[model samples]
Target: MAPKFFATRAHLLVCQGQSCQGRGSALLYKALWNHLERQSLAYYKKGGSLRLTESGCLGACSYGPTLCVYRPKPAGGGLEEAWYAAVDFPLATRIAGAAHEETPLPEEHRYGPE
Candidate 1:
């Protein structure tokens, strides 16, 4: 079956691969869902705003626990996607908030190994 688009063309892909799981990716995924739900209720009010997709590893295993935000652009314009790595609870929250606001992902927050 085709995937549902809960909120236009924006999507938040959470990685739940083995490496990420060991690094507490599950907790991050839960936090993202909660944040998205709360934001959707407050804004959309009808429930179901941001679409959450649980994905496998997004490479960057060195970073582990990664997520990518897919933001579709206007007609004919290329879509914008950002991959975040080394993410924890706080980082995921921020990402979800940005996605909820339909804003671009911040550069400073892009994660990776030190």
Candidate 2:
């Protein structure tokens, strides 16, 4: 049996693959954490929490500095995924803020789905 997890509403996976790293994912990861902290989006926070993770390759090597956000829908509505490709510092901050409900997802940065 697996241990019970905390109340998490969403998860952000920042690719740390060699390619993505070379494009600045490491610095982006730190920036995301800091931005989330300033916005009170700690993973352990009560109610809806936004968790950040350093992920391995997401199989989009060409899209370096990529990220994916996983948000579970309510009432068995399944999961929601949003992929952002070729991210820069400004877009990364927007992505983090969206996870915390501070802003809407930037469609311009979105790489998958509508």
- Candidate closest to the true structure, highest TM-score: 2
lDDT of 1 by residue, 5-110 (tens): 3455467788989988888888888877777676662223475446677898888777868888776764648777788878877777776666666666666547
Estimate the overall C-alpha local distance difference test score of candidate 2. 0.81
lDDT of 1 at 44: 39
Q: Compute the lDDT of residue 26 as modeled in candidate 1.
A: 89
Please list the residue runs of candidate 1 whose C-alpha ends up more than 4 Å from where it truly belongs after superposition. Answer: 1-9, 41-48, 74-76, 109-114
* C-alpha lDDT score of every prediction, in listed order: 0.71, 0.81
Worst 10 residues of 1 by lDDT: 41-50
